[model samples]
Target: MSVELNKTLFNSRLKLIKDAWNNASDSEEYGSIADVGAFLVMAGDPAGEDDPIRKGTAFQQIKGGDNPIAIEIIPQAGAKEPSNDAIPRFVQAYISHSRVGSLLKETHTGKLVKEWEALLAAANSRPELVEISPAMSSFMAVKDDEELKIVRTAANLTSTLLANYIATKLETILDKEAKISHEDFSAQIEARLGSGEGDDAKGPDMKVWNKNPKLKDVDWGSTELCYSPIIQSKSTASGYDLKSTAESSPDMIAHSGVFLISTGIRYKGYCANMGRTIIVAPTKEQEEIYTLLLGLQADLITNIKDGAQIRAIYQHALSYIKDKKPTLEKHFVKNVGFGMGLEFRDSAYLLSSKNNRQLKAHMILNLSLGFADLVDDAGKKVGAENATILTEGVKSVKDTLFFEANDEEELKSSKPKKPPVKPLTNGHSASPVKNKTVAGKVLRTKTRSAAQEEVLMTTAAKIREHQIELHAALQAD
Candidate 1:
């Protein structure tokens, strides 16, 4: 079965780009708009196929590998005909004859960089034609309902694959005294993804779009991974640095120690991310840190809402970490979370100390919070690579989408009362209240003990105390 392209979604996105172009052209801040022609040009495949700007503007996927393709969006003044819609007319794709076959002449078969250079030359000659890449990035950061649904589906697939891998295979693999390579683990994951069994067989057959040729008859489901599976064990998971390539040494997955598995999958051009740090034979410090990390992630989710400033959110996480475990502050990843949709991470809406953009409804975020460089009682470097003792999945913010926070009072009033502290048989805290919408479903707040809640409330109060200062700092930016 073939996947149908959502033309309406693409059309609405095109309208956003066109509107941004017109707004920029009219504004004096961009420069003189007299006779200058502004064109949004993006190269494909080995060049810019994965570019969010191109993805947002072009409805159809352009598969350009050795023979790359380029797309140009020129904003027109008005529709030539009375009834014809002008949005579709603005987009023009330039695919090379090598890729498109002999129907079209081989006019643009050269390097995509040269084509881009030519566009750059034209832009340099004309001052009014500003680079609208940033504008496009900003516009595409917030997803619409249809886009959210696709991303949610992709996220659900990833979650299922990850859950299945952990439940069925991880223990057996980790239990064996024999060495297991990262490639072996990654292959296992790929097998599950491409199994084409049961519900997995329902969708179009998966294809890695960038590496493979464009399907002639139908759009194949894109399984091109958003990033290489991160399978780091033992000392490898001790630090914050990410390993994309497979480790050269064998026995990457040790019999004991912490193991980190971060993986993402792409479906129909959109991406979803999920990660977990598995610990086998974890030390007391490792388990404590793991539980702490989970709690921090939960607190971060509770604070997230529409209209919240991205930087402020980061500050909140930072402040919470500092108040709870100051030593781990250095080990924490620089970014708390980021906006994700067409691209794995939308740069325009990064949840960093520097970004001041407000979070909006329909925005999906990958909330990443973890520690590294952990030391044991004797100060030995034993990483939380994989822990099986507290094997309950850490409720970190994976692929989460926000819904409209139109009525704060209503939301506050509807907040479910905290249930009595009931520990699970597995010794994990009971599931918390489901108050927020995420990934097209309701996401619950992380469960916290009375003491932990007291600490969090104290931290929140402290943050509230500095709200004015934080607001001032943001305004200064």
Candidate 2:
């Protein structure tokens, strides 16, 4: 399709999400008072058959049938106490449950009962709108019509807030170093959401956005994580992105400094993953490095085609650079680009194993291929890469990842662009990482809990087994 059509579709999808937020379910429609009342009385319904107390009379009914896809929500008074819900928001175990159960929960029953149970038990708040339910979590975990809206909304919101953060936090960082603390900076962003830090506000448990290091520190400002490995968007750094929280763990979280990346924005339960690499003044080396990384990303993504073999794409990436030159290896593209939703890197893994898997219909994958070269620079390196979606007829997911460089007009126009070839070595800067973002905390991120790593190893084994099965089936045919 034409570039105009591609952009038009992306904007349209984004607008729908904003509409959903503007028209969220109101208090009465959510049946908050009624849901709370019913649960309370189930414990003790003393009123015989017609007990007025047994049924909720506190709220009015919302007219339905008149409106399809009706959603109800209640903005209860800020909770005096934040209840603990034993939901597994970030556990790897839940990843195993996604495939079939996710589809079932959408038009049928939900997958995580424990998460929903938490809300059912929060009676003290008399919270007409208790959380800890399948609603928001389901949106994150599943990719359906409604869920897609949330993701698109989140992406747009992220860019909007990013301007505010860049002006308020990052842009003024070195100049106002003594004046701004991390906590103060974070709260500023919170306000834009009609939410902020108070004694009882929710934790920044936005796991899907994939928190980076700047969020985890106090004295140091951080960069935002652009392009989660799973979603496959290009990064401001111009280098490819790091993969899942499950993979990076505490080891990677240590490097999060001046994180210019963003968790995008959240609408209802859905959120988008947007990020930028944080840099101070522009150096000739820095500028050149950025161009190289970004150019590779642009070229590779635009070339994506029908029946495109993974190995062919892999070879094309390597060809861009004559030498190894921190080459775009086949393994990087193959292993990254997963399904986007509540969690990062859900449903799919990008690489093919022993079996050569072809792209299927409606599968959204992140082709997060990026690289850095230490060539000719004194020492510092840079990165560039992005994500694109594969659909039979719809526009590519690449539209969402492209930005005209909000304020970098001079840089945009001025370019002979660098030579495509650079030395392939371990000399350039290291790749980006994702995991354990603690804002204002002094301690280091805890290493990957051995338990979680064990689960990952087990998952790896299962993938191997599945590959064998696929290979056998393919061979039989």
Candidate 3:
């Protein structure tokens, strides 16, 4: 597919974001000063193929996992207990109640409504197939094979657009602001691509939206305002004058952390998951911390065996980091690995017990670890990553190297920054990182963890138990 068509998917996602933003805000909405509005609704991982989530409804129904609706999606709004994550109510309503219009087949709503009513009745009455509107039955049924391709195309296109944006502009965005034009950017990207599932898939030939006379098309959804701390927009001068503004705000720090959680840009149906932490202006201490964390991350990824006990990875990280800072282990900790697919946090936390679950092959996961100043991010003991996954292979974030355009000046005018061999420093806390290798791609190794089949069998059982509970919960009122 041409990059332009992929951008079209982002354009639609932008519309959806704008709609949600208007729903939330009543004040001047010229990019809302911060990207909080945008971030909350940003896409996580896409729903699995087998997952019943065709559109936004599944996110509403589950209200768990990384499905934009997850309680931990954004550490909960106005939350006093930072440890307790809750899905925002407005977000929930918009996703579930309102998005039914966006996600379900637009032409099939009235019938879907009737079918929902019918299904409600059937659920209370009987499980046997009963005569019903085709829309409802189909909605409740597995997605048609054709629909899957279209939706997947739509989604992958979005991911490609967002990934390109992040890859090309992420650093510039973080350091400075830029004019973002969803319309122009979308048009540019989608114009060339065709619609399909693979990287080379073609985007829709014509505009995929409607052209009726009575109503404004608003056919595709979109983002809230494409606002990031460093602007990543593609707007025009006459339409929306662009600016590249960068500043430090408490909001930026807190939300940037959250943004890192959902860094993979949302598009079409397939979601992307990637995150990186860059200290805007790093102190000597912060630089050291980044080095240590990056090194520890390397160790974690290298040790991720297909069947290794979950606890073993944790122990390796903890012990290795302890080799650097023995006393650092005294502080609180989170999960080191987790499954990633349709959601960011898929059925696990960063600090999960190996007794509860074990790593497995073919599971896409984000193995995260966060360290604080002998404390946490919030009053609740500064926060750090709490998850990783047990998988045979690893994906490196540095596979596509990004160099700051301004990095030339920074390097020429400044001292040559030496990277830490490993993040194992003793005693006091090392500072946070200014530049980072996001996820496993930061490392340049192809080593895999040892076989851990025994632990895998046990963890699989626990996952099954959790999944059964989840399915029942979804079926519940």
Using lDDT as the measure, the top candidate is: 1
The sequence of per-residue lDDT tens digits that candidate 1 reaches over residues 229-289 is: 6666664433423433333223456655556676777767677776666544344465556
Residue-level lDDT tens digits of model 2 in 175-293: 33334333344554554433435865553333312333222321111122322222111212233333332111111111222233433333443334544443332344333444444
Candidate 3, which segments miss by more than 4 Å at Cα? Answer: 1-164, 167-262, 265-268, 330-332, 348-351, 373-477
Question: Lowest lDDT 10-mer window, candidate 1?
Answer: 468-477
Cα displacement (angstroms), candidate 2, residue 2, comes to: 44
The Cα error of candidate 3 at residue 224, in Å, is 13
Query: How much is 284 displaced in model 1, in angstroms?
Result: 2.4
What local lDDT score does residue 363 receive in model 3, on the 0 to 100 scale?
A: 36
Q: Candidate 3 on 276-310: residue-level lDDT in tens? A: 44333233444455445655654565556456566
Each model's lDDT comes to 0.48, 0.31, 0.34
- Rank the models by lDDT, top first: 1, 3, 2
Candidate 3, residue 16: Cα displacement in angstroms equals 36
**Higher-ranked by lDDT: 1 or 2:** 1
TM-score (C-alpha) between model 3 and the true structure: 0.37
Of 1 and 3, the candidate ranking higher by TM-score? 1
- The better-scoring model by lDDT among 1 and 3 is 1
> TM-score of every model?
0.59, 0.37, 0.37
Model 2 misplaced stretches (Cα beyond 4 Å) = 1-147, 174-179, 182-184, 196-260, 305-315, 322-336, 351-355, 360-362, 367-369, 372-477
